[model samples]
Target: MRKGDTILFETPPAIAEFAAVGGKRESEGPLAARFDLLFEENTLGQETWEQSESQLQRHCLDLALQKANLAAAQLDLILAGDLENQCTASAYTLREVDVPFAGLYGACSTMAEALGLAACLAAAGFVGHAAAMTSSHFCAAERQFRTPLVYGGKRAPTAQWTATAAGCCILAGKGQGPFVKSVTFGRVRDYEIKDINNMGAAMAPAAAETILRHCADTKRTPGDFDAVFTGDLGIVGTRLLKEILEKEGLKLDNHQDCGLLLYDIDTQDVQAGGSGAGCSASVLCAHVLPALRAGKLKKVLFLSTGALMSQITFLQGESIPGVAHLVELASEKEGQA
Candidate 1:
């Protein structure tokens, strides 16, 4: 059923299993222990950084399936994406799996977008089992979107580190707990910020807009959720988002950004924090889902924000447009009632 801008799932899809994989730097972060697998090297024994990113997605999917006690043949569909040209990372990752695949490109918001779509399909009986995954590699993103590592470019203070990470979640029509209750797809919003280095500022307005819309659509307030998570907004974008929300009469007290939670910004030299498609993906799988399953969090909102800009667009001096997607998750106890 649809309510305002939100799609309320009549039968909430359960996150049957999930996995998180991260690179060396992420393994050094505060949430390191939460990740299922960590690679000491960015390459993961692959010939190229892009190939390594593919491996990250592949490994995450494999792990999630293993945890669910399901095979690739049992999966009805796989929705995946990445921060690569043509979404090659996800395509190559599933090439040998022999499953129906759909590629998505929501920039950094790919995870939430993929998960929301998968949940909708699952609830509608279109698929019994589906996988949603996304990945990003620091080296590959640097080579594609900015200067190559060899350039030794000086990053701005507001610049964020693109994480070398991946996450996968397998949703089933019926399962144990941690259900996806609803979803809100965000609209594109451009703030006319041209600096490619400061993605947090470029994406903050959209985050605010989406949060406000979701709240109004559901007739809920910040107090209704145990927590609100914004994907990869970093330090700068997070502060801006709060300010924007405050001005709109919404004061969020239990808010956290996956960017900030993924790393120890002060000592990590990550400038603002982490930012990438994989940043929130890995964090959601590693930390948030577990909390929901354990009943530590009764209800929560996961919002993934993205800067919808390409290298070509940035080079052409096009202003960055941002988007955010929201998914409502609840524990089994709450979902059942």
Candidate 2:
């Protein structure tokens, strides 16, 4: 039933195909080969980081469409976003691709946000096929959010490296497998966290909010799903979320963070691990979806977390606002029919 902010899709939409493309650094990570394709260079043949960001989105979309035996023109709608100002990276990427486009921005949570909206539209018979995608570039994000790359200032230990990657997933009114059963859109949350360096802390409450809210709204427990995946909360935020959930008497038995899973904490020296819209996007498409397809996972809750802070807001000493969007994915063999 379409009630409140969450939509329970009676005819759950299935992912037809998905593609995750990453930069060189991401390719060297634990889920290395899980990525559909990897660019050996961060430029991706683009002359600028912003252009590279656009290219990343295009690459993922093209690959996803190719895998699904479809073309850019075949998609009924494209819901996508990125961290760039105005979401220009995603907008410019699909500007000429010729599909009905909708630009979204949930920061890192865009992956779930885009997917949930697409699933709802598709499942409701509003579209025959839809594509959800997002991308981010470390250099581009750093330039926009922080300091100059050439400045080379010391990065705080609490900081997370923005992932340079992109992921795309296609959904149809009906498809083969890995269906989206529900969506719980998050409300903006503020913990009054002022440290721009500590995004995990800023976003953890929102993640906790969406998770518990999804449980309360759906009448399910943490044990109901085989896995619960949160967006880029890294180590610190993951711990904070656990504590918050524990205080509420709901222990997350099977939970992991895309940020923590993206990089090697010990060897990579990525500080708190990876964050950005692409972190969850790439990981979900490349790793989690594959596991679901393989029957290794049955039911899963995917939460993409985002920080809603702007440079101006941060400069003005305002607190960071956080958000998280949730979607339930189930293996095709096990999805409600």
Candidate 3:
């Protein structure tokens, strides 16, 4: 059922299995041990960076299916997305898989968006099993969005590193716990911040708006959730998000950002932090969902933010618009509510 800007599922879909794969850099990060697979090099035996990204998605989905003890043919649907142009990485990755596929492009918010749609379909009895996955590769994103590695472009301090990682989660109509309870889709919020290097500032407003809407629609406060995670809002965006929420009389004491948690900023060269579709997707699969399943957390809010801008739009001097999608997850005990 619909409640204001949020959709509350009568029968929440359970996350049956999930997997995370990362590149060399991510393997050295704080949550490296949590990943299901870590490639020594960014290229997973692929000739090109784009092909490597496709390999990331394929491997992540395969691992998830293996963990679930199911084959691709058992899935009713597959929703996938990536940072590559036209979402080609996801398209190429799933070409061999026979499952029906839907390509999404919410930029960094693709994971949350995909998971929300998958949950809704399962709860409505449209599908017995669905998979939600997304990926991003640093080399591929750099080549597409910025200058090539050969250019030696200087990055701004506010710039975030695009993580070379992928994550996938299989959702079923019936399973043991970590249920998707509700979803809140965000509105496009353009703050006229045209600096392409600072994605956090461009996306912060949208994250704040969606978070507030979710809380309002659900008649809950930030304290109600065991933890609230934002997609790729690095240090800069995370601070901005908190400031925006604070003005509305909401204090996020339990807040954590996927970008910040994925790497050790003090040691790593990632300016602000991590940013990409894979940033949150990988962290969610590697860390958050596991905690929920282990009974270490109860109710949690996962909001993935995205900056909707194209190279053409950037060159045209058009302002970037940001969007965030929220998915509410609860433990099996709380799922009973």
Which regions of candidate 3 are displaced past 4 Å? Answer: 333-337
Q: Can you give the TM-score per candidate against the true fold?
A: 0.98, 0.98, 0.98
For all candidates, the clash counts are: 0, 0, 0
- Model 2 pairs whose backbones collide: none
Give the runs in model 1 whose Cα sits over 4 Å from its true position: 333-337
Worst 10 residues of 1 by lDDT: 328-337
For each candidate, the alpha-carbon lDDT, in order, equals: 0.93, 0.92, 0.94
Instruction: Write the residue-wise lDDT of candidate 2 on 1-337 in tens digits.
Output: 8556678987889899999999988988998888989989999898999999999998899999999999788899999999999999998998869889999999999999999999989988998999999999999999999997999899899999999999999999888878999999999999999999899999999999988888887878878989899999998899999999999999997998999898898889789989999999999999899999888998899999999999999999999999999999988634452
Candidates ranked by lDDT:
3, 1, 2
Estimate the overall C-alpha local distance difference test score of candidate 3.
Answer: 0.94
